[model samples]
Target: MVMATTASTAAPTSLSSVTLEVADIEAARRFYTAFGVDTHIHLRASGTQSTGFRGFTLALTVAGPATVDSFVGAAVDAGATVLKPAAKSLWGYSGVVRAPDGTIWKIATSAKKDTGPATREIGEVVLLLGVEDVKATKQVYTDRGLTVAKSFGGKYTEFAAGQSSPVKLALYKRRALAKDLGVPVDGTGSHRIVLGGTADAFTDQDGFVWEAAASPAPTPS
Candidate 1:
C-alpha cells in the first residue's frame, strides 16, 4: 500500500489500523478477504459490550467497470446484500453493498477509465461516517490536528486523502446517512469500528472507539 503522508506538519496521533465488530468474526473476515481486505478478528471478552453502527460505509475505487463488476460480484457471492447494483452515475459506474456485519460498501470506477491498474484497482478505501452535524464533526477531527482534503454541501465532508492506509475518513449528516441507507438515523450504541495506532483509548466526540495498537519507542533504554 502506498503510504499517505500526513497533511499536518506534526500529528498528535496517526492511525495504525481499523477494527470492526461483527456478530461473526470468521464470517466478516471471509467477506472482506474475498473483497480483498484482510481483517484481524478479536473475540470480545465474555464481559465486553457488543457493537452496533451509527452509520458507516467503506468505499472502494477501481479502474473500470469490469473491475468494479468483478469485485462487487465477489462481494455479493460472499453473502453481502446489494443495496445498489453496479451502474453508471454522476460519478461513474458505482454500486453499494452491505455486509452481514452491517458495514456498507460502495465500489465505483471513473467514467474515463484509461488510468493504469496501478493507479486504479481499489486505491481508495474511504470510511464514510454518519454524524449529528457535518461541520461540527469535521471540526472535531481538525481540532485533533488532522487536515481537511475537501468538503462542501454542508451535509458531506472528507479528510485529506493519500494516507499510509488507503482508508480515508469522511462524514455526512446523520439524517442524510439514514436516508442513504434506508434506515433510521440512530447514533446511540457501539460504533462497531475501532481506530488503532495510539497510546491511549478514547472515544471521538461522536462516540467512535479507538484503541492503542503500539507504544512509542523508549528513549535511551
Candidate 2:
C-alpha cells in the first residue's frame, strides 16, 4: 500500500481494512456472501449495545444500472431489507438495503442506463461515516496522515484512494446521510464498525474506532 514518506519507515496513508460488528457472525457471513461483498470486508460477532442508525453506511459502486439491480437483487434475496428501491436519481441509479445485522448499505452507479448485461462485479466500495462535524472529522483524518481527495465545504470529505485497500474512506453529515438513506438520524451507543490500518489504534471524534493491522490488506482480484 502507498503511504506518506517519512524520515524513518513510511506510515500507511489510507485505511487497510474495514470490519463490521454484527450480532450474529455466521448469519452476517452468509448475508455478505450472498450480497457479493464478503470478500471485500471482514466481520466480527459483537454483543455491544447499539441502537438506531450506526452512523455509517458501506456503498458499492458498480458499472451501470443493470449491475446495480443485480447487486440489490442479491442483497434482497439474502434477507436484506430495501430502504430504497433501485431507480434513477439526479446523480445516478441507486438503492439502499439494511442487513439483518442492522448495517446499512447503498448500491449505486453513475450510469442512468445499462450498456451491457448485469454481472456480480463491483467497481468500488466506500465506507461513508456520518459525523456530527464533517470539517472536524476531515481535519482529524488529515492530521493522521491521510490526504484529501475531495472536499465540499463542511458537507463532505473523501480521503485519497487506497491503492491496496479494498475499501475507501469518506465523511458526511449525519442527518444528511440519514436523509439520503431514507432513515432517521439520532443513533446512540456503539458505531458497530472498526477500521484497520497500519497506524496505532484510537477512536475518532465521532466515536469510530481504528486498530493497527498486523499486515497490509489484500486487493480484491
Candidate 3:
C-alpha cells in the first residue's frame, strides 16, 4: 500500500520531516496517514491562541499523475477543502488541500515513472512561504544563516538545502502564491507555516512560525 514514487527527479536536499500542530492529534494523524504520509502525534497544551495556515509543503517527485489524484482525492475525501482541483499546473499534476487544522498543503507530482515506496511515504517537503515582499522575506533567512540556493526576480526564491534540514525553505510573492493556490490574493490570513526544526520557536519578519525539534520526529498534525 505505502510506496515511494519511482520518479527519477532528484530528491530535495535531504529533508527529514515536517511537523504540524493540531488541537486533535488523532484526527490529524488519521487524515494524513490515510494517504500514506508518515504521521506522528505529540500532545501539548493548547494555549488560548488558535492555529491556521502559516505556510505550505510541496512535493515535486511522485509516482505519477495517478498518485497525485489518489493522494489529493484522499485528502478531499478526508474532509479537506479542495483549494485547487487536481489538474495541470505550473509544476505538473498538482492540487491544494486545506486540511482540517486549517493547514494548507500543496501536493504536486511529476510525469515521471513510479518505482515503488520511498524510505518515507512521501518525498522531501519544500517549506513554502507567501509574502508581500520577496526581497525582504529572502533577507530574513539569509540573515538567519540560510544561504539562497536559487532566486528569481520578485517572484520566487529557495534557500540552500542542507543535508539534515527538516524541510527546504522557499518564498513566493503573495499574488503569485494565491494564483498558484487558485485563491484570491487577500494577504490577510495565515500562510500556514507552523514548522519545527532543531532550532527554537521563532516568528519570521512576515509572521510565519517555526519551532525547534531535538531529532527527526515522526511528526503529525
**Per-residue lDDT value at 164 in model 3:** 58
Q: Residues 23-126, candidate 3, lDDT per residue (tens digit)?
A: 67677667767655534323332323433334344543455666777778788888788888878756567778877766667777775444554323456567
lDDT (CA) per prediction: 0.64, 0.86, 0.60
Give the per-residue lDDT of model 1 (tens digit) for 1-221. 12223233344344445667767776676777777655322323122343444467677877888788787888899988888788887777888888767777788777645444433256666777877678876765665565787889678887764344436678887678767655556545666777654445556666666566553321110
Error of 2 at 175 (Å): 0.8
Against the correct fold, how does model 2 do in TM-score? 0.92
Give candidate 3's error at residue 195 in angstroms: 2.8
- Regions of candidate 2 where Cα sits further than 4 Å from its true position: 1-12, 219-221
lDDT of 2 by residue, 17-98 (tens): 8888888898898998888898788888889998898899999999999999899999999999999999999999999999
Worst 10 residues of 2 by lDDT: 1-10
> For every model shown, what is its TM-score relative to the native structure?
0.76, 0.92, 0.73
Say what the RMSD of model 1 is: 7.4
Clashing pairs in 1: 4-162, 4-163, 4-164, 149-160
Best by lDDT: 2
Shift of residue 89 alpha carbon in model 1, Å:
1.5
